[model samples]
Target: MNNEAANILLVDDEPNILKSLGRVLKNYSVTTANSGPEGLAHALTTRFDIVVSDYRMPEMDGIMFLEKFMAIQPEAIRIIVTGYADLEAAQNAINTLGVFRFINKPWNNLEIINAVEKGLELKRILQENKALADQIRQQQARLNEQDAILKALEAEEPGITKVNWAPDGSIILDESDIDDDFKF
Candidate 1:
């Protein structure tokens, strides 16, 4: 979960904007794409921890780009950056596209850095949680299997004494406690 190791994608049609943002976010691994189609192509080919895209671009807008990006990489964090501060676009980005943050064109360097850092942190947390859940599921499956085996053994030996684990870790199936009148 090192911030420096996280991969980020920056999509903007303006070269200067891309350059400036790239410089500001130089600490992390940043990949830039000129347009929505290019960004979408890169998204399909590579995995990114975060994606910051401009709201207005040729062929496809930021909302559409983010929506498609979500389909391809649902786990990637999405952010929208644009000079045009349209309320509708911001709402759409958040409500429908699930954008992590909406940033204006004259963004503060500190704010942008913080947003990326937080996004990466969130991604790491989600990954860890998923792994822990999987491990729990695997352990539960193993316990269920053991329980089934014990039940089968009990069905076969109705009056059999409970099996114990010896000090040496071996199973001790002692039948000395069985009543004398009981058959094998």
Candidate 2:
């Protein structure tokens, strides 16, 4: 695990709710957003590893926030803490937003921390995967460029010699390898 602390975003329209959750997660790096649109703006610009949102809010509900958040930052792990667990809303959260978990209102501090920790773990794994994928892509590009150079060297006229190194880092051809048809 990384020694760095987790970056958490607390989103809720109610000032009291945001303050309470912020206090609960005081040990970590916490950023608060008051509305869904405000949260979206912050999330798009900020670098948060996880987002915890209240389900009931004016202007935009948790569901809508989740949707917008997923579009902008798909790797972020999300949790919905709501006073009411309507089956329809729960289903929508799962199907549309792919929320990591759901918590009932009046949550336990320990439980919230645990969920946030789990979300951070998942985010780390995703970041690692993305880095590995980018490395592979760069390596492939380098190989392609090398291949092009090798092809160009090979296409030289008969008078030119194109020599390469062996896997053991030894030159494949010395002066003796040159024949009447090819010159160094």
Candidate 3:
């Protein structure tokens, strides 16, 4: 989906942070929450394409909130924006929680917008890969069913499933392979 169509959720205890995030992502379908609880509530009903949250909310930190949120909507891309830039927090957000981005507070508008756009691009690619994998699974199932049918046919009439075509495209059956009672 395009940026305009993508749904984004901004969660922070500070209203100013939420406002700034929302303003930066104005082109997208944006929703703001004052706390993690409210964000979770929104997640329960609406599916967001991306979630940008502050790391130090009162109800729950961004990691905790995102952990629960991921359980609810694993497909939504997760991003943490925090003024508190610590290596441990960044590692946990990226490594443990699978956050897509760790954007710092006092973020430049272009940087935030770029991060969101990249997150949307990642989401789109993942969705496409999932769809392709599903299609391949379905095709493999069909091939398996056809193989079973072929095996059954071979059991009933030996060599019936093997067709030897000559250069002229005519069936060339060996005398030994042809069943005694079989007709052309």
Clashes of each: 0, 0, 0
Error of 3 at 163 (Å): 1.2
Worst 10 residues of 2 by lDDT: 154-163
- Models 1 onward score TM values of 0.86, 0.76, 0.94
All candidates' lDDT scores?
0.91, 0.85, 0.91
Runs off by more than 4 Å, candidate 1? 159-184
Clash pairs, candidate 3, are: none
lDDT of 3 by residue, 1-184 (tens): 8877899999999988888788788899999999899999999999999999999889698889999999999999999999987989899789988899998878999989999999999999999999999999999999999999999999999878889999999999788875789966
lDDT of 2 by residue, 79-169 (tens): 9999996888888888888898889988898998888888888888888899999999999999999888777776875324455879998
Candidate 2's C-alpha runs over 4 A off are 1-5, 157-184
Worst 10 residues of 3 by lDDT: 175-184
Model 2, TM vs. native: 0.76
